[model samples]
Target: MTMADDTDRYGRVSRVLHWGMALLILWQFLSAGAHFLLGDTAVEEFFWATHKPLGLLLFVLIFVRVLWALMNVSRRPQSVNAAAKAGHIALYMLLVIVPGLALLRQYGSGKSFEPFGIPLFSGFEGDETPWMVAPGDLLHSWLGWVLLAIILGHIFMVVWHRRSASQPDVLPRMWR
Candidate 1:
């Protein structure tokens, strides 16, 4: 699909951001699962450490992607159908909101917010008040599962469209 801009279907920058974010998301989920399965050991600690920083990185990448998308709107692949379009929008919204709510949960619990060893908020004492940690943790956990569900749904739709509709190149365009 040609556009007014003289760029490849996906362009190098977009492809980089897309894959980078995808890898980070995968790492986030796996690390979280490891934390649960391993349970308070060094391995769990190690994975948790990676989780916060990686999540923060994903947040930053999302910002970059938003800017890139705004600047290079014409270069994005055309939507295959209305469902695809809705799914795209839902994915974007979830990506942005999920991390944001996680961050908010950290903040609202009066926990330190750190990204890459840099504290987003510093020197804050945690709340001893009941329900502070519990609610935040619940929301964070539930939203994480919901995000995973949406991601799985998105992948299924992509595969279905590609295989059934003979649009095998649909996903490749985002990396072209």
Candidate 2:
């Protein structure tokens, strides 16, 4: 029950953020899936409404998690291998980039954003910023799906590593 990350396993705060983000990401994918697979139906409508607010929430959570991760970097367990380390870095990058691009697009589109009524964006008076909107429109959904694929790969690697020839189960570090 450590409160900070140690060399052997993640601490309570890290575990909490890791698992919390997992659930949130799962919900986000569900929302995306509904939007992609169900389109204009009631299910899509229901899920889509939550997507924006949830994305903002995930963004904030990730920001905090990154700061926490930085604080605990020296104390965290070593990566099992280069691949594991790269995968982790990629995951973090995509987590930030996907939502980051979306928010950028939101602001650039000159549409007011007040998720949970916080007034994040104040809206503009002319045409949308094509640059911001373009990158987001081009990469957001695509990269989002890629992120999902990477996450699936991450899950597989976690389980696969549990049976690795050289180490203990990696799952326990984050899960237990």
Candidate 3:
């Protein structure tokens, strides 16, 4: 198999990042769902604990994915149209923004954060940084759901394109 993307299909690394992020996003949503719908339960406890660390993981993965995409841009398969291209751009933006806001809030909370024992932030003394905390508090969950909606739309577009006679079956670019 090819290690780099071609005009017709994604390379191994691209496919791994794409699908890997997809799965992580799905798990993130599940954690959020449990927190929301199954509050104060073991299910929520199990899933919610992973939310922050996984969000941090995703934040890092997205940057790597973005750089990879940029590096492979010229050789990658073409987007179906302006809308498809725009949709992808939107996806990438949300992927960055959602976790970014959360990380901001985390730093603002005046608490140490050591995801997977990496020691990302050491707690600071004095009052918490409200400015940093506020944006993430206000937008993190909201943008996350928005991200979910957009992802669903993306999946729909893919399926629609595959089933429709007018468009190409684009899944093979990443899947096959």
Candidate 4:
């Protein structure tokens, strides 16, 4: 109920950031899925159009969420265990890295990126910077799929915990 986190649960801001990012990430995956399975169709194009801008927004939100987490570290609920802590760390890392690679690729391509009509960079006239583009090209999609797998694992754990009598229902910490 409070704006700031307490030892028992996440605060309003944390929950908002957590749930908001979850929804955004879900949308991103939908876009990716459509692009993969239904390429060249209206569905893919419609979803793909929102991908870049939404990714940028997600990157910004994750940055803010990390800062907020740090600020509230002492007051926030403790991780259930080391595994839970590590899982969260992995999620955060992927959240940052995935978009970061995309941004790097965008920059290297020297193509004008105007996500949501806000120009982040202008296009250049020469060849793309191979170094910046390479990592993304090699790992972006693969790691993105890995991130999605990890996310599914995360959700599975949540459900497992919620259903197990011996385990704690941690959802209430973030959910109202």
Pick out the ten consecutive residues of candidate 1 with the lowest summed lDDT. 1-10
Return the clash pairs for model 3, or none.
Answer: none
TM-score between model 4 and native: 0.98
In the range 1-176, model 3's lDDT, one tens digit per residue, is 69899999999999999999999999999999999999999999999999999999999999999999899999999989999999999999999999999989989999999998899999999998999999999999999999999999999999998899988999989897
lDDT of 2: 0.93
RMSD over all Cα atoms, model 1: 3.3
Clashing residue pairs, candidate 1?
none
Model 2, residue pairs in steric clash: none
Model 1: per-residue Cα lDDT at residue 1: 32
Model 1 lDDT tens row, 91-153: 777777767767766766666776766869854674544454555466666777778888898
lDDT of 1: 0.73
Task: Output the lDDT of residue 129, model 1.
Answer: 40
What is candidate 2's lDDT per residue for 13-127, written digit by digit as tens? 9999999999999999999999999999999999999999999999899889999999999999999889889999998999999999999999999999999889987998999
Candidate 2's TM-score: 0.96
Error of 1 at 108 (Å): 2.3
- Span of ten consecutive residues with least summed lDDT in model 4: 167-176
Residues 5-109 of candidate 4: C-alpha lDDT, one tens digit per residue:
999899999998999999999999999999999999999999999999999999999999999999999999999999999999999999999999999999999
Q: What are the lDDT scores of the predictions, listed in order?
A: 0.73, 0.93, 0.94, 0.94
RMSD of each: 3.3, 1.1, 0.8, 0.7
Please report how far candidate 3 places residue 79 from its true position, in Å.
0.8
Please tell me which model should have the higher TM-score, number 3 or number 4: 4
Off by over 4 Å in 1: 1-8, 126-135, 165-168
TM-scores for all predictions: 0.82, 0.96, 0.98, 0.98
For candidate 4, the per-residue lDDT at 112 reads: 90
